[model samples]
Target: MRLHEYQAKSVFADAGIPTPDATLASSVDEVVEAAEDIGYPVAVKAQVHVGGRGKAGGIKLAESRDEAEQVADEILGMDLKGYHVDRVLVEEAVDFVNELYVGVTMDRGEGKPVAMVSTKGGVDIESVAEETPDAIAREHIDPAFGMHPYQARKVVYDAGVPRELARDVASVLQTMYQLWDDRDASEVEINPLMVTDDDEIIAADAVMNIDDDALFRQQELAEMEEETFEDDLERKASEYGFDYVRLSGNVGIIGNGAGLVMTTLDLVDYYGGEPANFLDIGGGAKAERVANALDMVFSDENVDAVVFNIFGGITRGDEVAKGINSALEQFDEIPKPVVVRLAGTNAEEGREILNDELVTVEETLEDAVQRTVEYSEEEAQ
Candidate 1:
């Protein structure tokens, strides 16, 4: 549920946060028109979900309408980290004397929302942290009380921003916190928050990621879903009712729960393997769900081996076995070898049923992961 930069900026503007005037363009002509409307010296930014756009040359400065059209032509069809850039944000460029970073995100360890601020901006915060950890200031806000004005003021001042702009920045932080909390967002960030020569503060960039679980409450936000860039496998997986996240590794992982899926991925890494994707079939692992999960994992060409680790408590092991068989029947060819580890309720019966199948079954989780890793390595060789 990550919003594009333009979408996030729209939310920010609605929250009374000052930001650059921007227009969404889906074509070169639209971009030129937007630049003409915004009046020159605009920034044409690729509206992709991933980061490092600037490093990838996805962000270009256009000094005039003609330059805007040329840059848009070059960027519109360009690929950024495997995602095709179909749209660009044409925004009025501004001159600023200072840059800062402000963001609010959930802290799972603290079970609260934390506000992160730094005077150093317009660059990757991770680089700043690795080079100068002290440059970033973090303050956790109590969920019960929310982010008070005084707390935000303290965070802003601690970041070493000038005294004149501290209050303005603090106010923007408070607004961002409110927007994040009200919208049930996982993150709300304003990178390179700028202060012009006139001492006016504005948000130069906005990025927001909403909590998918809370989408039921925000129907308006839910309707804004855009599938223009999603791959065929991802769309199909969503239609089949499985939580799937595509990754870059060679091992495909499927489990009954998120915790188990994550643990299985870690184990794969521990066994010297990389997980290609995270596919969670949820707590109720019916045959259809299991089949859907398997189909999705096998759909990935990067998967050299598949691992199904299920500790069936709420989900029965036999049902999962049936799903695997169903998936095998549905697909003419499975791309990789599969390893299964079934434990808990009716595990023995499931193992007996899958014994005649082509899948390799292991009695222990570690053994299953080790075998998958070995199989992947052997296949690669």
Candidate 2:
């Protein structure tokens, strides 16, 4: 969903946007090699997901091979905002007279894509906004008609872009908009869009985040995603077709829908219990699916107790109960205490069918959560 700088720039170049010539390197030797190839005065920047890389000393300037090697050695393997930097981009340092910021992202309040331009660049846009809100100009673009050229120019001019560079900036903004639309991107940005005295524009920094749900259609873009997942359970969750997120809490939660799962998590927190994970079985989940969900939750060592909150609509409570029973049968001994709260269609029958000896069935969500939290707290002691 989020891209490292080098990866984002690759997307930028693919869209015909001009960027500083750069090379990706995974080692100090490779960094020096890239610097040599790009010719001196290159910028060595660590590739990480979070912002403030510059502030974290993740970025450095190297005018020679020795400096490049030194910079590379210092950056590679360094942690930037909790992300380990394994790669660095060695880019040709642009001789620029001006810097600007250009970005396109959804303004949820307006329910439209917002194209933004600011004369203040190479700095945190948020700080600029807080300090001088008027320095940034925004234009709301309709998804139906897309970004018009006039609107782009107006935004650029309002950002106080000099007359000579207004057209070029506008062109870049349109290209960015086109890229956002064409790639199913939730956001695209070019910070410090450097403008040279030679009347040339280049993207000095790139940031793009594609919509996770849209990855299905954007095959090529999706392929560009980092091949490695930091979380093994998350990788397994994807394979198992479960809407899941791992958490640090001891009480594992399973529900039929996203909203229900979220509420269950909130309740776990409110009851003074930490939620170990978020697992949504989705509507109409069968016995087998429920069994699979149970297996997944039990696999987590962090989970001390599990709670099943089912408000059946399309999801039949009987099926869910059957799944819980079948899944518990697979274990020679139950891995953790499990609490179930069944409501709506066939809930009473589902409750009756459940193995009372194996799981605790509660009448209300609060009772189920409270009982599960107690189990987890007992485990902690």
Candidate 3:
């Protein structure tokens, strides 16, 4: 549910936040046209979902239309963190005296939306936090009360910005908060909220991530989703009604609950193995669902081994076992080794059913995780 920079900037502009004039281009001709329209010294940025675009040669400064076209052609097909850049944001360059950071995000631990601000901006906020924690200021805003003007004013003032820009910054923060709260956003960030030489403030870069659960309320945003670069395994899982998130590990996890899925992934990591995905089959682990989940995991070439930690409280373990057996019969071959730990109701019968298979069955979660990691590592060597 992450919006591209241009999409986020459009939202900010609609909310009355001052942002730079920019145009999105998908081709060299479009980039040249956009740069010519915006004039010389424009910034060409790749439109990708992942970060570190600057470090990955995805961001470049073009002093002329020719340069813009050259950079755009080079960046449009380049991959940034596995996501191919299909477009570039051509924005007019501005002369700024200082840069600052402002963002509002959900703090699950605090159960509130936290407003974060810092004088140091245009860089990874996490690195700033780890190196200079004191430079960043954070305030938790109660969801019930929302962000007040006085609270935002205090943040701007505390950040050591000039008095002339405080009110403007406060206004931007208020508008951003409105967009965040009204649209059910997971994060809204304006990096390098620049203070221009003319004493004007503008958001140089914007990012917004909408809550996937709340997409039901945002038809327009949902329609804006572009799935051109989604992982193949994830798309397949979605087609089969399972919630899947692909990760970069060898051990594939399948479980009944989200909590269990996450715990299984952590265990894999703890046991010195990476999780291939977080695949949750929901509470009802019917034969179809289990088979679909296993099919999705086995399709992944990176998966060296599979781990099924099914604690069937509501879902019967025997049903899950049957699904696995059915999937093995359906597919010509299961690509990787599998480790199963079926506990809770009907566990003994499920264990007995899988005993005849080549899969490893462990008594404990730790044992299952250790065995999967060992098997994957051995296969790798």
TM-score for every candidate vs. truth?
0.82, 0.66, 0.81
Q: Give the runs in model 2 whose Cα sits over 4 Å from its true position.
A: 226-381
lDDT, candidates in the order shown: 0.87, 0.90, 0.85
Distance (Å) between predicted and true CA of 348, model 3?
3.2
lDDT of 2 by residue, 186-240 (tens): 9999999999998889999999989999999999878878542234566667887
Top candidate, metric lDDT: 2
As a whole number from 0 to 100, the lDDT of residue 165 in candidate 3 is: 82
Give the TM-score ranking, best first.
1, 3, 2
Clashing pairs in 2: none
- Backbone clash total for model 1 is 0
Model 2 poorest 10 in a row by lDDT: 226-235
- Model 1 CA deviation exceeding 4 Å by range: 64-67, 77-79, 82-84, 94-98, 123-133, 195-200, 213-219, 226-231, 246-251, 268-276, 284-288, 301-305, 325-334, 352-360, 370-381
